[model samples]
Target: MIIDILAALFIVAGSFFMLVASLGVFRMPDLLTRMHATTKSGVLGAGLIMCGVMLFFVDSGVTLKALAVMAFTTLTSPIAAHAIGRAGYFIGVPLWDKTVKDELHGRYDEETHVLRSPEHMQDKQDQP
Candidate 1:
């Protein structure tokens, strides 16, 4: 009885987070922010849903599959979101007007397509 209740709770919570993620994608002002919202909430939602599934199922095979899916979702979601956001930025997607800072402003080289860190820039200056 307790297990069933817990599973139901997890599913409800996961569904809520997934709904929030969907809303975020539509409501966020820019590509990066949208990706950020979806990546975090979507991964959590998927994990939670998988957890619920694992709990509800009595079979070892279902548990293993759920675990594998959860692992894959957790690992890939953020990486894929980051790559997509980076590509969007590289293609000159504009940030929201209210954005306060652009840390990547001078760090990325268009010609070489390389992003240099503050430490790397300091080292280059010291070398010369």
Candidate 2:
């Protein structure tokens, strides 16, 4: 009885987070904000679903697979979101104006001196 109750609660919580993620995907103003919502809510929702599945089906192989799925989601979702956000930034997608801190801006230029292509480097050498 207790397991059933716990499973129901987890399923409900997971569903709620999934709904929140969907709303955020539609409602967020920019790529970064949407990425944040996607990563956080996705991870949490998957975790809750896995927990509920484990509780509802104790000792089953399906539950083990769900656990693995949850683990993979936890590891990869944030990384995928970050990669997309970084790609968007590099491609010159403008961020929302309300964002206050842009710590990455201008920092990559200082860290790396090689901005142009090898062809440009060859041209520069040929000029001298």
Candidate 3:
């Protein structure tokens, strides 16, 4: 009885967070922002849902599978988001207006695919 109650709570929470993540994808202005929302909340929601399912299932095999899937989701979601964001950036997708700052500005060299911060840039400039 208690397990069922706990599982229900987690499932509801997971569903709510997943819903929020979906809404964020639609509402956020930029790809990076949307990626952040989807990756963070999406992983969290999926993790919670997996936890609920694991709790609901007492069988060891089922629990192990759920855990494995949760682990995979946790590991992959952020990396996937990062790859997507970086690809978007390198492809020249415009950032949203009112962006406070671009730390990558003047730092990245497209040809070499290198990122150098101010100190590195200064050092290179002084070398010649």
How accurate locally, in lDDT, is each candidate? Answer: 0.93, 0.86, 0.91
Clashes in candidate 2: how many? Answer: 0
Candidate 3 deviant stretches above 4 angstroms: 117-119
Q: How good is model 3 by TM-score?
A: 0.92
The order by descending lDDT is 1, 3, 2
For residues 14-109, what per-residue lDDT tens digits would candidate 3 score against the true structure? 998899899999999999999999998999999899889988988899899989988999999999999999889888998999789977777889
Off by over 4 Å in 2: 109-128
Between which residue pairs do clashes occur in model 3? Answer: none
Cα lDDT tens digits, model 1, 1-128, are 99999998999999999999999999999999999999999999998998899888868999999999999999999999999999998889999999999988888899999999999988988995
lDDT (Cα, 0-100) at 3 in candidate 3: 99
Per-residue error (Å), model 1, residue 33: 0.8
- Deviation from truth (RMSD, Å), model 1: 1.6
> Which candidate would rank higher by lDDT, 2 or 3?
3
lDDT of candidate 2 over 14-114, digit per residue (tens) = 98998899899999999999999978997899899889999998887978799899989999999999889987887779999999998566533434633
Which one wins on TM-score?
3
Using lDDT as the measure, name the better of candidate 1 and candidate 2: 1
Residue 7 C-alpha lDDT in model 1:
91
User: Model 3 Cα displacement at 5 (Å)?
Assistant: 1.1
**Full candidate order by TM-score, most accurate first:** 3, 1, 2
